[model samples]
Target: MSQPVYRYYAGASRTSRSRSAAWSALRWSGSLAVALYLSWLALFPYPSLSGAAADWLGGPIHRALGFAAYIIPLVLISALWRTFKEGRAAGGVIMAAASLASLISGAGVLAVSTHPFGVSPASWGGMLGSWLGEGLATALGGFGAFIACAAVFLLTLQVVLGLRLSVAAAWIAAVAADDFQKWRRSRQELATRMAGAPKGDDAVKDAAPAPAPAPEPVNVIAEKAPSGKGKRQPSRDGGPMPAASKRPGKYALPPLDLLKAPSGAGNTGKPQESEIKSAILALEQTFEDFKIEARVTGYAPGPVITRYEVTPAPGVKVSAFTALEKDIARALKAKGIRIIAPIPGKDAVGIEIPNARPALVVLREVLEGPALPPDAPLLSFAVGLSASGEPLSADLQKMPHLLVAGATNSGKSVFIHSLILSILYRARPDEVKFLLIDPKRLELTFYEGIPHLFDPIVPAEKVTVVTNPKEAASSLSNLVKIMESRYQRFQLYGVRNIDGYNKEADKR
Candidate 1:
């Protein structure tokens, strides 16, 4: 599964860019108000806008306004800084230029009002010459003054806010980057653990070595007993005639030694093969009246135990055999044994005995088995061994999604890896995509090149790996957006599922 990435927004319509723009506007507006108020207080003692008051306060007020004008560019630069920090380089530059323009305009107004001497007097020349010089000079001078002030103000503001913003941004980036790295590391570690874990069936298969080739078929003669009192009759081939005969079931039990209990803490040593064969035969004889099949599947030598697999004949309900569990257990003469009736989807039953020599169930063998269907459900998972040493396969379709929990090295990671491999083998890249969430990093790194992977095994760009649960929840909500979009597309096409919609698109 891949982790989802979340974007913070006030509403769906407010993109990160839009929010930054709004923040810039607010900062500018606030700074402008503060600057204007300070200018007004410095320029005018009274609140009145009368001519006298304008004359008295105009010069000071103009300089104050000019000072305040710097705020526009300061706000703009600050906004730009923020946007740049967020990787919006173009937006920041545009905002900075706009702020600079406001500063220039403010300077023009301030110079004319406060520095009247800078321009030639009206009496110095002809009416047109004096008019042009005074008007042009005042305008130009004021503009220059405002620009200079704005530059100074911008510099000061940058020093203060720049450090803070930069530090904060760096910390955030480092933390986010570390979080992503940790997740990748954890996923890789998990994969390694799973690859090495032992399988259950392996234990059973390792128990008994292959028996020596069977002896050649031999001829045998049976002596017939006297019927009540008559002497037994002989067959024409010179063989003895049997007094009584009976036919056994289709399947025959292997030797009893193959069914002995595993040797370990309880058992003094490995039980002889003869001991296992005799026990199984005796157990079978006890159930002779019923139609049941029992065979030793595995042995563990250290504890000298054996595992027995049992199955009921066709048309025999599992309930019919379950009733004899206690009886069969008693007959086996073992302290404990488990029964799995009607083994999942199979018709056969499963019975486990402690192996006298546990077998090793190789993953390679399981993967190659004919029973492993290519079209097995997508979400099915290979769990570890069952008590009987059979590979435990579980269908994830029932879970819809799984919440795996286990202590470190308890096989959870291995289980996940097996599941991922299994799913990849069964599904094509186009049919299935993974959304991996590896906050621990090591669990999923090896699958980077696997076609089914939706993104790099490691998180990048909008693909996020967050350590915080709250952030993870936010990412999930973002996924909800994706799901919604998909659903909407489905609705437009009158399709109820992803497959249907995809098929419809393909037709076009």
Candidate 2:
């Protein structure tokens, strides 16, 4: 049976994606163009386009651009107004100011005595500012009216932006009063000190103290270590002396290379360049068959999957291609396909197809590749390899807990062993402890006595495994008690969790 499926990237719906794109385009193109045109009008009241192309195309382009100028301000005002209504005070103030200017100028208050920009005032900006300026000049006589209107605009800006001027005014008045009082008091103190000054020679003699002798410097030298024979100490077992002791240091991490290497470990036959090209062609063909417009932009081959990135044409919903997963899979002669519509933080959709020859990510290979940060917590472990073959690791401390469940023979036991081994390679025994509970005794029998255990503190073959249901329940009950104890300690210290508790304990 053919299956058609579509998974929305990061749970974002189509409407949200469209809105985000629209807002971004409008903010960048619309707002910027308007701002620039307005600036040009203010700077050069009369400017001309001079060139052959200008002579041919400039007239029509100029008219179109003039329409754009009016449209840009209107769009900006609408956007700003919407943002302000959404509880953004700054947007409100910006919208109010822009509207005021546009209104006054557009009302025909400022008639262009001369075309400053070599274009008619019928274009877009400067209408409001000119009109407001003319009305103020007629009423209050230029400068007086300009100053009054400026103050009114400033007040309007403050009110629209939700700034309380009363608080600011009061604060300024209080600061001035305090400063005046302090200055007066300081002047009085200065007058008093001048009146009480002693005669010059007597004051100087009294103020000066007798000169003292300088102390002698002491010689210092670095301490020399006791001389020893340049011979290695014999090991306690009477073998040739070991280079380093096996005993764990106070802050020592478990060494790397403790995990086993993969067997038959030659390179897995990943898809060839020809296979990739065919796959891309297959995708394009499938889309064409479905009457959908899409082009495969790129692909990243991962351990078990290859992700093909697809960029759709304008006005095409990514969801359309996503819904054709099964059809595309059939066309490519693949078992199945999965589609990610409009991948997060990217302007493209992703189609993930399973690799023909999947590569296995070995635990040791990841650890040996790069040194983990020295301060990484004991709980950090390699999860797997990412799509681009980068080692992916995760911190169990951040997770705090985990639950692994799967069908029989699903490599669950191997995964658990890898987790335990990863922890053993990083954490010292004193730093972390593990409580292993196994109802199906076969799985955890291998990890019976690895130093990091709590119940089976001393290693013994028969004592560690919990085979019965009752035994497993008892172990779990004890774990609950331990969890409660930890909670009490966390509460006492006013900390949030184990991480917080550990940080506080470390500080002490």
Best by TM-score: 2
Which tens-of-lDDT digit does each residue in 1-508 have in candidate 1?
A: 2222233333445676788889977976775565565445444534474345455555444333444333443554465456546655434454556444444433433444444456333222223223433565656564554455445545544442454556767999999999999999999999998788666888547754666675442222333334422222333443322212122222221211222222334334345679767766866675575655544444333232344555555455777667877777777665666667756875566655555454544343233332343344555555544443334567775675578788988778777877776555445445666766666667775665554544332343344334445666666677778889999999899998775886798799
Residue pairs with backbone overlap in model 2: 45-116, 45-117, 46-116, 104-128, 105-127, 105-128
Candidate whose lDDT is highest: 2
TM-score of each: 0.33, 0.47
Q: Please provide, for model 2 over 161-231, each residue's C-alpha lDDT reduced to its tens digit, 9 standing for 90 to 100.
A: 44568877899999999999999999999999978988688887776666455333212111222442122
Q: After superposition on all CA atoms, what RMSD does each candidate show versus the true structure?
A: 31.0, 28.4
Q: Which TM-score value belongs to model 1?
A: 0.33
Clash count for each candidate, listed in order shown:
82, 6
Per-model lDDT: 0.52, 0.61
